[model samples]
Target: MNAPDRFELFLLQDGEKKITEKIFTGLSNTSDFILLKEDHTLGNLIAEHLKQAPHVLLAAYKIAHPNVPEVMIRVQTDGTITPRDALRQTCQTLVQMYFALGREFQKEFALRQFADQGDQGGAGNAGGQGGPY
Candidate 1:
């Protein structure tokens, strides 16, 4: 039997974020299934991040391999946002998180330095009393 032609469907697009559905007609019937199996975890991560958007109604990704591997992504919104917007927001949130962590590290490092200086000063003032005779 001849394989069908591969095609992609766009379920939604509003000049911004878009959802794409890809159909891999004959790939799923192959003996190697590792890539397809790994895609499930990747798709779940994407769906979870996309759902963090405030205007997102629903976001999901699935791979069907009954005969061939087909990937589908459906992202619904409240008409006030797009998938692109949600993605941008997610990136911004991640950046903010990283920045906060860096600041905390800097604060901790400064505190450690201050404590070490105080210890050194106190030891110097002890006038060789390092060991209790």
Candidate 2:
């Protein structure tokens, strides 16, 4: 259902598939708790990374049903940031880290290539002359 004040909670079901959506107005937070889903890897990954965010007091997922692959996540912040914001920040940080790691790897690869060329006696001038130009 939709709330006038921006906060709302509702359930969406399609045959055997169901999802509970929770929305918080003040913090502008929203999350979906999935039930009977075959894969909970994305929820678990988000929980793992959201825990490292600043002001995040708790970020975890749980399996509520033993018979089904039901998973729910509760992300809490210290009033400084919304749970959605925290998760967004965490994802941004991960992207930044991934780029930084890629840059580092490129640098290492370039250095290794230079070393290999040196070992192959290609350190001198490109021409056949061994001149110090």
Off by over 4 Å in 2: 1-45, 62-72, 120-133
Candidate lDDT values, in order: 0.51, 0.63
lDDT of 2 by residue, 10-127 (tens): 2333465544545534343434445445336656776888877778877777876654456776777787887667767877887787787777777766776777677895564433
Best by lDDT: 2
Candidate 1 overall lDDT versus native: 0.51
TM-scores, one per candidate: 0.40, 0.52
RMSD of each: 15.4, 13.4
Q: What lDDT tens digits, residue by residue, belong to model 1 across residues 1-133?
A: 6764443132222342333333334333111112232345545665677677677776676676644343455556565765456555765876676687777767766766677677875543323222111
Per-prediction count of colliding residue pairs?
Answer: 1, 0
